[model samples]
Target: MTKSGHDILKDRLRRAMGIDLQTVGHNSLRNAVARRMRVLGIKETRQYYELTERRAAELDELIDEVAVNETWFFRDDTPFTVLQRYSRNWLKRGRGSCLRILSVPCASGEEPYSIAIALLEAGVNGPLFKIDAIDISYRALRLARRGIYGRNSFRGRNNFFQRKYFQKTKAGYVIAKHIKHSVNFIRANILAANLPILNSRYDIIFCRNLLIYLDKDNQKVVVSILDKLLVDEGLIFTGHAEPGAFADSVFIPAPYPKAFALTRRSAVVCKPDRVSYNRQILPPSLPVQPLWFTELDTARELADTGQHEEAMECCEQYIRRHGPDKEAYFLMGMILTDMDEPRLAIRMLKKVVYLDPNLVKAIEMLALLYKGLGDDNNYRVFKQRAGRVAARNQPAGKGSE
Candidate 1:
């Protein structure tokens, strides 16, 4: 494709999905375009560009090729913890007859399914909550509607939910019928003028990781749409890199460690440091933590909120005060990975794995870091190790229906 044609197609993608070509990478856009052209048997770039202009369906096809749908169940784990607590409160207080939640760009089905599982575990019955899962990729939506997931979708150390809510099948793990029924999946771009959910208001919105791919102007536009869709005191859960997108908007960070939640400025009834909602929901029997533990918690929260420098300082201090701690090293590895220092992150993750050989998350991180650095030997070694550890730690019984 010529440079001019590529530029025109990039602009069209920006207008259609609020995507920043630079963030998605120029090479990725070029590759997606080339793949679509090949699939359509078109030889000329100009003809393909003209076809995109003439047919909306062709543009949609291009979008399916370009969209990034990498996600897993309980990706971060903290946001769902926050949601469980918040839903328990909503149910206790009788805030409404039904709690409404929205998950946009809910890649595949893991996120919405995870949300349902969290609520169910929190004792919120199926009839008391409604979830709307939306995505723009037709291919991803089809997979989501199938409600079947491979091992890649179930990451992390916990497979308790998998054992409880999914049936092991030859194809994959088939999601429970009730959990699949709980989420209503729809295919529509969130940036469209006629957004499907404009007429509705939600109590909770999970818009994680979508804003980072957009330009500054589109970021602001998305924040406005989120504000319009949220109720007066509703919460917005965003990705760790996305809190800055709402910094100048009507949203303020909610007081919960690692939750990455925000609420309207007008809803700030309590001080920022105090977690009144958490206190209300936390059981009285819960134990208190040591001062050093709270400091590490603060470091995790800082990292989640994009204060990488401060977070690194906190980690350094923790290491200085306490001798080489595996948890601190693991946290440092994660922060370094986010800062694009794969080598440094690899060192930290290696220290973590050395201290606790069976720590599957750290092992997985080492595999990914090695893969990123193009060290296929080390990557394969750690990848195989992680798989072995995961298999040994699997829940007692095979998954049941």
Candidate 2:
């Protein structure tokens, strides 16, 4: 296909599905399209393009090829902890008859199932809650409804939850009956014109790691749709890379450690540092630590807000005061990446891995940077290391706001 033909194909795909083919990588998009042509016995790129426009089912198959569905049960455990507290408080207050939760693009069902298990452990029974899990990929939704997962889905330090909620099978871990029954999986696209009109409001919604894949315009559209689907004062949980996307939205970060949950903005203004919503809150006073320790969080906040220069300065101050903390370096590396300084970003990220070999994120970033730079050898090396480290001591309880 000519370059113009490829560009046409990309534009058609972006219009069909709100996903930007560019984010999936040019080579990957072309490969997926070529692979699909072979599968359908289509002769040429133009033929496939026409089929994609005419046949919705074929377009969905193409989306499945490029979709990134990497997730695990209790992937980040802190949000579940916060949900437990939220469920308990809702029960205590008799706020509503039942809690309604939504997990859009609930890849492989790990997240929604995790929420159900957490609510169960918190004494919030099935009668008191309902979880709706939706995704655009029929392939993923099929696997989710099967309620079985492999070892890769059971990563991190939450084996107890697995043991309690899943039955070990020769094939994989089959989710327990009760846990599997808790969530309803539906095939729906968030960008569909009628999505908000079709779905009822939810008390809490989990739409993590999804907006980062979308371009800015689509991100705003999805955010607005989410806002409409949420009840007033409802909470939303997003991925670490997404706080900046919501910086201008109708949400405020929930006050909890490693819980990247946000509450809908109401008429009354709420302070960021106060977890007033969580009744059983931990006091802010920590046993007297150096002022520098507190500065790390300040630097992280600055970085999260996209004040890269200010955040870098804060990290520099911390390094001068304490001489290179691993977390500080990792944060600095992330800030530099956002600043489009790949060389400085690579240096900082490498320093993070040198200081703490188990820092999986730093290694993963290094692999991506190498891949972007066409350094296939280093990319493969760091990618392997990242996977190994991730399998062993998968970090938890730390993410964006």
lDDT of 2 by residue, 295-400 (tens): 4554665566676786677677667756877777777777787788988989999998898888777898999988888999999999999989877774464422
* Per-model RMSD to reference: 17.0, 17.3
Cand. 1 TM to true fold: 0.69
Candidate 1 Cα deviation (angstroms), residue 56: 0.7
| TM-score for each of the candidates | 0.69, 0.66
In candidate 1, position 26 carries an lDDT of 65
lDDT of each: 0.84, 0.77
Off by over 4 Å in 1: 268-401
lDDT of 2: 0.77
What would the per-residue lDDT of candidate 1 be over residues 236-271, giving only the tens digit for each residue? 999999999998799977655477888887762111
Q: How displaced is residue 311 in candidate 1, in Å?
A: 15
